[model samples]
Target: MKRCKRVAVVLPVAAGLCLVYAPVAVADADASIVSAEVSGTLTPGARASVKVVVMNHKAPAGQKSCISAKMDGGGGTSCFDLGAPGTSVTHDGFMEVLKDAKPGPRTVTVNLLPRAVGGLGKDTKTVTATVGNAPPACDPVSLNRDAFQLGHTEGLKDGREDGFADSYRQSYDDAFKKKPGLTAEQCQDFALSAFQNGYGKGYETGFKEGQAKGGKVGEKEGKEDRQKGNTSRNVTIRQLRVTALPATGEADCAQGVKFTASFLGSGTGTIQFHWERSSGKVPGTIEFSGGDAEPKTVTDQAAVPAGATTATLTQKFVIDSGPSKGKTAQATANVTCKK
Candidate 1:
């Protein structure tokens, strides 16, 4: 392009980008696009070279013909001097798809631009190129690991306590046969490869069995200890006190006998108080809860039967937590009733 300058920049595919540039004066004209052809392949994670061929309705010698090709949205342009009316030019450029490009057909466009003084035309044509999947890299260690995982899964699926060992061994042996020389420094199998793979398999099997057995034994021991109340920390119920105001009362016993229950202890727990009228056939009993600590008190009115002469209230406070959980302290108070 003598009159109009164009710079074609072919960016390296390694950078995941490709560029083609052709800068020309913009104008609308009437010219026939003889032919516009684009050919390329879409490759995942690699650059693809595209060949663009364009033939136009000819222009003067000083006119310019620019061919541009775009692949998956990346485009580049190249310009050539129009020799005759049947002028044609081929543009070579590259385009890149994403490393994780999906396997499908990608759109590629080829544009033809004729720079003519009298009047020219802009033409574009689009075609599809299939992007192929990337080739798999060779990795022996990964294969081995995959085999090991499969074996473990098989063992679990078999529902046998010791099945994992045999299953893992079999899978590992099969993998070893396929990739005998495969080794990874970080892999546990690397050192085991020196010996028969079976030995390593057996060791793993036994280790798993031992672990299961040890877990069962530990669980059983823990259960037995719990049943025996063999706790590392034990809380003891040290004292219990009960008091009744107006220990001797008459028919006024119905007036409300105040019974106070106090418990003293050194632990964190709830103290349950069970109060009952044991002496007289009092109909109702009071049950309340208090904190397990020094000077924790609970008070409730003692129910006195209509004809009862005395109300003997018996009470007990039980610890509901701590090492001394379930231990109890007992106290009693007497309320005499007289008409």
Candidate 2:
């Protein structure tokens, strides 16, 4: 059994309206499987673990329903009631069958029963487990909480052992006292330090290892696939925001024009400012300055190339791309998502 190491699963969307529909699909799709994955190699008599998670798949939104294991190799089968609702579920290896000699290709069918009813939906996914193989040396990783990023290990615990309980206050103090804005990397660093200092130091190892893996931050670089050619994964945005400062243009060619996306989203993502020609003469060399850590303006505004009607601008988040396909994204572009 070739165990697929993929963690997240991309589910089916409706006929159209990709943006507003993902959460809906995850919540309402009765027979569809969002993500069902497995980790670990089973040796004859060795214990392996399986994990699963769903997005708003059941009542209370965050809780996962139930899961069971069925052995396809010579090994026997068992099920874990989970005993309660959770957004994620995990179970250790088959204790009874670990001593058996069931080797070679096998399958561990992970059935996610959301509510003891139609919760598992009509279509559920199954991942394979290699009965005999050289197991990975590193400890398993995780991608818990609200989001799942790519080109990065899914579940790398920071140094903090007690979750957010002991470290948030210290982290907030450091971030506020030292800088005006915090990047993801910096936040992770702060989190790592807090987790490490409060906890032992083991939790710090996973993250460094995960980051040592050089990868960009984004959806296209990891386990989940991006809905290509579709707006679900790719997009072009135009943000028109009302600023606190007056809209009066300055006479100085250098400081006259203005741009702001770089100033928003807490610097977590890039913001491109294009002078909507429809509004006014797209000012030449529009300069940008923001209340971010790197508080310097792009004074040497790049010249707009010939044949360009609206200025071409780009801003990117310092995130890793995919181990899967494109990922689901939410943005504030001044346009409607197509179905």
Candidate 3:
């Protein structure tokens, strides 16, 4: 940590980062950190804090220690991660970063890391200011948001007809700045908590972890015989539709898609909201304005839009009078189909 051009900041459970950035020294380290609370956006007042952790590599087994400091990146030496070694002392609410002033790349003072925990008396070469921050990557947001909090709730399976999985990974990870030196087991659970809040009732995103794929023993013979004799029919009970047009300028971690749906034709007799899965299909839902309505009302409905693959959507309504009386109505929720 002392007299170094490139300091490696090793994060436990994961390798450290290379603090091969810039460094700036200041006459008063503590005063500068207290004065440099970078902030932005408070349509929502921004809350900020500084963590100063000091470490003594050569200190004796049972003696107290001293600390020094520095900053870098912006013209001011007000940026850093830790100041105290055995403990992380933090300071908050000193200054505010302008909402309009774009945040430039931020770097920590590596040399300052050791100096913060002041060197031994008369030991000028013990530890000096270096450049870089801990955990390597600076996640300002994780500091602000809970690891369990759902940030950009787009495509939550609980809220959608089909559970959206793959899309939520990054945002979930972003919410939790996992603790330093976290274990592998801890990491797995850490990842789970990030998306836990997203799996609210009515929407279960994860799979049933322990149940077997095969049927249970001591099954009823009547049901087994009926199942062997009966035919399996596909039913498209509900559909999904979205209204937003292909949006331009999606956020850094989003891919916005938009579309609309309709149940233009009617089932001359009975009608019902539906759900179904085909040989190869994604689960979807029927549009509901909170109450049961006719198919025309189903027209121009808002849903998650047609996905990349195609599926046949059969509207299961009865038409009693026609030669196909009592037969279900069939339609395709296809992109090329007429609205």
Best by lDDT: 1
Off by over 4 Å in 3: 1-18, 21-58, 65-69, 72-107, 110-198, 202-339
For residues 148-203, write the lDDT of model 2, one tens digit per residue. 33212223343221122123223323333343234434445444444333233333
Better of 2 and 3 by lDDT: 2
Q: Which stretches of candidate 2 lie over 4 Å from their true place?
A: 1-32, 57-59, 62-64, 73-97, 115-123, 133-339
Instruction: Rank the candidate models, highest TM-score first.
Output: 1, 2, 3
For candidate 1, list the clashing residue pairs, or say none.
20-76, 20-77, 58-85, 235-324, 250-338, 251-338
Error of 2 at 147 (Å): 42
Q: Indicate the TM-score of model 1.
A: 0.28
Give the least accurate 10-residue stretch of model 1, judged by summed lDDT.
1-10
- The sequence of per-residue lDDT tens digits that candidate 3 reaches over residues 126-226 is 11122222222324345213333441142132233222112222222222223113543454455445444333421332221101111111022213323
- Best candidate, TM-score-wise? 1
TM-score of each: 0.28, 0.25, 0.19
lDDT of 1 at 11: 18
Superposed Cα deviation of residue 93, candidate 1 (Å): 3.7
Q: What is the C-alpha local distance difference test score of candidate 1?
A: 0.46
Task: Judge candidate 2 at residue 21 and give its lDDT.
Answer: 11
C-alpha RMSD of each candidate structure in angstroms: 36.0, 21.5, 24.8
Every candidate's lDDT: 0.46, 0.32, 0.27
Ranking by lDDT: 1, 2, 3
